[model samples]
Target chain A: MSQELSDLDRRLINRLQDDLPLTQRPFASIAEELSLTEQEVVDKVRQLRDDGLLTRFGPFFDAEALGGAFCLCAMSVPEERFEDVLTKVNAHAEVAHNYQRDHALNMWFVMATETRGDIIRTAREIEHDTGLEVLMFPKKREYFVGFRVNA
Target chain B: MTLDPKDRAIIEATQAGLPLVLQPYTVVAETLGIAESELLERLENLKKNGVIRRIGAAPNHYRLGMTANGMTVWDVDDSLVDDLGDKIGALPFVTHCYRRPRALPMWPYNLFAMVHGASRDEVHAKRDRVAELLGDACRASDILFSTRILKKTGMRLRGQKG
Candidate 1:
């Protein structure tokens, strides 16, 4: 369901993905750079968000950096019980960003909690609830990758 | 880093998103009963500490025509995974690349890299580039395209203090 975007919108989307200036008049800089008024920049951002082209426009928090924990867990839910297991697993607030991937370990998701211990606790709870094994694939190391949309 | 009470308030206020306005910080600060300067200072500190990765906008890729999402997993030689992962991550097309412990017997993949494109063919073409880059270090690899989004509510902070 892709929709056509204006040339200006394309540039704005690409620029917004980068770090926004943290200032009282943050949009002022963006406006100056884009050769638009501050109000115009703000309005475009608002419109993009309102149109659902932008999911969020704010600080991206790192839970692990804030003393919380995040773990990538997967489970091979039986095809017949996928729906039931999904409901049970998604019921938890910690189960963030669950996806149904086409693989044996099909149901993959990331669990973010207030602490490291909470990761295991949630996994056990899901296993008990779903009657399936939750394989935790905690990141041993992360390679830096700058993610940006080429609007 | 431990978040102060005000920091927690700031997170709670803007976790979902910051207001879309000429001065979004002003509105958030006023709502939280803090001066704009103080709120900006705290936010600056949080960014420095890596608690806040960045202040930016996340585009809805699906709406932006990037409909294909592939999670490419590789069973690379343990000794070379890190070095290879660094290269893979640097490729502009690879969104996220990480080395995770392999759950042997069932799961033999240790490297996970996410690629997105306008179509599955485009994604696979990019995946082929990654495979070419890995050369002999990658023993076996597979890609898992997401069939559906079962859940996508990002991390939510508990109401009670930690």
Candidate 2:
């Protein structure tokens, strides 16, 4: 799964992390700035996504700002049943991001939904499915931190 | 911020992702049966109103050589967590930082900062720097490394109305 990326790919990856202009020809502006043709830029992005280098692309909607709610939930699954429990938990679309963290409460995930009430509802549903208590850590205050990876 | 039907449609269309084409917005606008200018204007407004954080690509950190992803949790004094959290969030290596309520007994940490590095040793070194910055203000801390990414689909608005 690991492959060496060219200098052009690295530079393009870094630039794409920043906000893409909201223009009719957004990729054109990016191509001009990166000194590449529009087709080259688009092709590289598509290639990156195809190769699993990039997860997803486009508008990152902040659920909270859009009247949606997000909650960080964790569960301690038995070692033997980890996979089974994961399948059941991930079945819900509300389970946005799930990570197997190294801790007593091993299974950590985030639930994003349209309403705060829905967060609890989905948690209950998961608990019923997996029979594990879901610990909810609703963010009280988010410190302004920009998330960017140096590729 | 209430979303009109058109706005919801736009989100539904692009939430998965924009098409990998030269004229991505034009494609999306056509799919939604609207003018390209209207789609661009609505997108700009969504960004201005904070609905959209950014329109860009999310590179896989692991693929980018950031293999170690640690969630550094700290039990900072409630009185000073805000001030200290602001400082920790500003740390160059810290990616996402937030202050959440602690679940008593089992979970006592309230401040969470995500740190990524090439290796666990590097992550530990960065964690040490965070400890130094926190000093005595942080009562106890722990680091949790993600063993695997079970799922990574980001926030999605369900098609059915709530």
User: What lDDT does each candidate get?
Assistant: 0.91, 0.90
The collision pairs in model 1 are none
List the lowest-lDDT window of 10 residues for candidate 2 chain B.
Answer: B153-162
TM-score of 1: 0.94
TM-scores of the candidates are 0.94, 0.89
lDDT accuracy of residue A82 in candidate 2: 97
Model 2: CA > 4 A from native: A1-3, A80-93, A125-132, B160-162
* DockQ of predicted candidate 1: 0.75
Identify the candidate with maximal DockQ.
1
What is the TM-score of model 1 when looking only at chain B?
Answer: 0.93
The TM-score of candidate 2's chain A against the true chain A comes to 0.78
lDDT of 2: 0.90
Candidate 2 structure quality by residue, lDDT tens digits, B18-92: 999988998999999999999999999999998998999988988888889899999999999999888889887
